[model samples]
Structures are given as structure tokens and as C-alpha cells.
Target: MDYSKDKLSSFLEVNYSALPMCCIQKAEVYMLDEPSSYLDVKQRLRAASLIRDMISSTTYVIVVEHDLAVLDYSSDFICCLYGVPGVYGVVTLPSGVREGFNMFLDGFIRTENMRFREDKLSFKVSEQIDEVVKRTGNFKYPSMTKTLYHSNSTMLAGFLKPDEEVEMPATTVSYKPQKISPKYESIVRHMLHEKIPNMYTYPHFKSDVMNPLMIDQLMDRKVQTLSGGELQRVALVLCLGKTASVYLVDEPSTYLVSEQRLHAAKVIKRFIMHAKKTAFVVEHDFIMATYLADRVIVFDGEPSVEATARRLL
Candidate 1:
């Protein structure tokens, strides 16, 4: 039951300045379910490091985690568990971490000759997200001046600090804010016209946004009367339908289910690439962010106050 300040901080959201710790005298095997659920990237790494250091020849640690990177860094073995929760689940025989992760990602354990999921999960690194930032450097977005910085200090767009003054190029732009307001009865289609004119006629949008978001099912509902998830989908489509050099979408996965979030990320990425446009997305859902981003930005500072851009990694 014992954990250090840094370790506890990784697991908790509260301030850690004068934190306390409680120690356990004796224990052996330990288990953690979704250990990295609440942590940011930095905190997740720290937690993984602490757990990694705790492992011994006699100590067997079983961590039930969803984040691939954190699991890869901490665990020595991998056991893929599938099937519906509160119903039935089957755990694969333990395998090496890499092999297990690969099996989990591939949706088939080759050694066991078993296939679980029909839909495979593939990971895309954040380099494409960085490339979006890099693409923005070709022109100047003088009004889009704020830098999304990191703790150690790296700029995503500009080569230098504000004093150094490197210009960013973005001739055309479209942005979807974190908060949105409803304006019409058929809010979904109405937003499309208001924010992304001709969205219904936008090529591939039906497949990319309309189909995945089930916009057809939602088109009849009033915008203000729509559910959170419905509204989010409409907002996302609005952001993607517009023709622009760069798209800045804030918190696209909010009020969505896990599966919907995944679909949203893929849709966002596909539309951006299809249109040959750049996008900067600010997302809180870690899994969706990792899947959608080409470059992940890390901001370090006070959480709400003085929360400044720190770096792009």
C-alpha cells in the first residue's frame, strides 16, 4: 500500500507540494487495474518507472492497463483479456511483453493460434501531428500567435521564442471551439451550413463524417435539443467540412463513447489528409489524441492558472 510523493502524484490530480505517504510492511504479488487511466504522459511515465523499479525475482506484478506505451514500459509479461465485462472474459496465457502487445494490437495471438477481435487496432505515431505544425510554417498566421509550449520549452511552429519572432503561414483557416451553441431545429445540418457551407456536398464527408457520426439519424433533431454526443458529432463535421489551409479543433472527443472517440480521430485525420490541409487538435482523451496526432504537444505549468505552452514533442 506504500507509494512515494511522485508516485502518488502520478495517480492523483491534487497538488503534491506537501504530500504524505503511507507504507506497508509486507506484501508480495500486486495488481493494478487501469493504473494509467488518470495520468498525463509525464505522470504516466513516472508511474511506470516506479512500478518497473518495484519488480523483483519473487514479485509478480499484474497491471491491467489500456494505454499501450505505459504497459510496454512497465510490464515484463502481457496477458490479453477480452470478452464483455460483467459477462465473460478470457485471458490469454502469459507471453513476452512485446509479443503480447503485438498480439493485442493485431487482435490475434499467433502462438496460441487464437483470434479475438475482428477489427484490428493499429497505432500511428504523433509525427504527422508535428508535420501539421511544420506545414503551418510555410505561411504566416499572424493572428494565430499563441504557442502551445512544453515544460522543457520547445516551440511547435516557430523556430524561436516570441522575442526571436518566426512567422507562421496559414492563408485560410477554420476553427471549432471547445464550447459550441445550437442555433437551429435541425441543428446538425444547420451547423454544417452556418460553419461549413456546402458540407452536404463536400466530397467524402458523408463517408468520413456523416456515416460515422450518424448525422443522417441526427439531422432531424433541433440543435439545442440534441444530446451531448450528437452535438459533438455535428460540431466535428462542421470543423472538417469547411475548406481551409489549417483546421484548429479543440476537444473533439468530449461527450463521446470510447468507440465514437476512435471513429472521430480517424475521421478527423482522414479528412485533413484528403483535403491536403493541416490541423492542430487540442484533445483531452489520451487514447484519441495519441491515435490522431502526428506530434503531441505537452504543456507544463499550473493546471488552470498560468497554464502556458511548454513544448511540442
Candidate 2:
């Protein structure tokens, strides 16, 4: 099924607020029985009840809020609460663990916890948590405390070091364009249908310098040459000509109206899916990115691109 259809199916099946409150509380696990079709209120309630039941059966329940943009301490705590085996070591303190659950709600804590796990295989929230536990007199519960170490010098030293240069392998890095095979020609033709001015004559001008009707009109004596947006579209068409395992495009919506930009994005995505080639596009427009990309990346001035890619995925 198409992306929109899949998303709508999921949305309908998991729409908790739409379902009856009682059903949501009693359900175990929800599955998309017929993902291709739309679901009514009754179907949604049944799905929610199944999911609720599954969650209730487990010792530790984790509820991930859909609107949560960042996973924080609460998310990590929930994950750890569920992930660890045996109920003996795990502790669920009284509701008054902190002054408010705000500290545990920020995603930064979750990110830091992940970093701690990667570096030390253990995560300890601040000593304040222990203080809070003592204040509330929940000390009888077996609690797990994690200690995090902070070293300014070590952090600065890593930042000061020069970034390692990536060397392109000699065999794969070539300056010349590889010839397009006849089998791949069909894919190219299909992609060109939307970008090309006249679909009828696209086959005749695949490799020729002859511009499309729009390009010709722009270059006419009465009108000025093509604008930046027009040039970018031409650049995009040229980029698609190369043969590669993956295509990395950065911000194709530089100068275009909303509708036009969306149209361009759809065309590019179709090409990628049709060719069965991986496409990595970096975009700041959230709406367009959500519609066009399979995954999104949010950069935070970090040295590693993988860090951002992981969060997006």
C-alpha cells in the first residue's frame, strides 16, 4: 500500500482518543487486521483494548506519548523499567519521586542516559533522585542509582582534535559519467514525465541539449533567462543522470512556491522508489520532509552525522 494509506490505517487503528475510554483501559495489543481499509469507532476501540491488555500483562508498563518530540529521563526510566529482567531489582518509587516530573520529562535526560549506556553500560540519574527518594521516605524499595561523570578537559580535547578526512576509494571515485543502460532508460523516462515540459517528445530529447518548452519560453527574446528556481530544477534533472547506489540531495526547495516544491519532492521520491535506490535528503521544511522522506535528520552541530540520523529514525 501507499505511504498515506499505511499512515492513515495506523492512525485510525491507534487513535486512542477516538475509542471508548473503557476499551482503551482493558485492551492488550492492537494490530492492523486490514490495513488497506479505514476503521470505524468500534474497530478502533477493539484495537485499543487489545493493546491495553498486552501492556497491562507486563510487570512494567511504558507509555510513549505520540506528541513527545524528545525522549527524556521519563522515557529512559520507562524503557529500563520494562527492559530489565526480573522484578526483584527493579523499583517503582512512590509518585512523589521528584518535586515535579518535569526533570524526567525533558528529552535531554534520555539522550544523556543513552550516551551513558554507550560509554559506561550503566546510567545513573543525578544524586538528587536519591535525595528525593529519601525525602519521600520510599527508601525501603530496592532502587537503582546511576552516576554520571563529567570531564571538561576530555570533552574539550575531543572537540579540539581535527576531523579525519574521508578518502574516496580509487575504483569507485570517477570523474566521468557512466553510460546509462537501455534497461535503466525506462526508469529515467518515467521520472522525466513530470519534470519535462511536454511528455510527448521526452523520449526524443533524452540526451540532447534541446531545452524543454518552459525552458525555451524563458529564454525567448521577450523574456529574461531562467531564474534560480528554474536552474535548480535543471540541476536536479542533471544529478539524476548519474549512476550510483544512493543519491544524497540537500534542500531542493530552495526557491519555489509551496505547491511547486511539493510536486518536485513527489517526483524525486517516485524516482528513488521506482529505481529501488536509497535517497538521503536533508531538509529543514518539516511538512515537506515528513511527506517526502522515509527518515528525517535533525542536526545539532555535532561532529557525527550518525548521531542525528539515529534520532530521526
Each model's lDDT comes to 0.63, 0.36
Per-residue lDDT tens digits for candidate 2, residues 170-246, read 22110111111122223323444434446324543332322421333323221123344554554456455455565
lDDT of 2 at 295: 49
lDDT of 1 by residue, 1-313 (tens): 3545455432234322121111122458676655554345576677778678667887767776666667788878888888753369898899998888778778887977778878877656654334553634332222123332221121233333443354445266666665566767555556566666777766577887789777888766678887666778888887677777777786776566455667788889888887777788876456778788776555555532233443555
Candidate maximizing TM-score: 1
For residue 178, model 1's alpha carbon misses the true position, in angstroms, by: 1.3
Model 2 misplacement above 4 A? 1-162, 165-224, 302-312
Worst 10 residues of 1 by lDDT: 15-24
Listing every candidate in turn, what is its Cα RMSD in Å to the true structure after a full C-alpha superposition?
A: 8.2, 24.8
- In model 2, where is the ten-residue run with the lowest total lDDT? 141-150
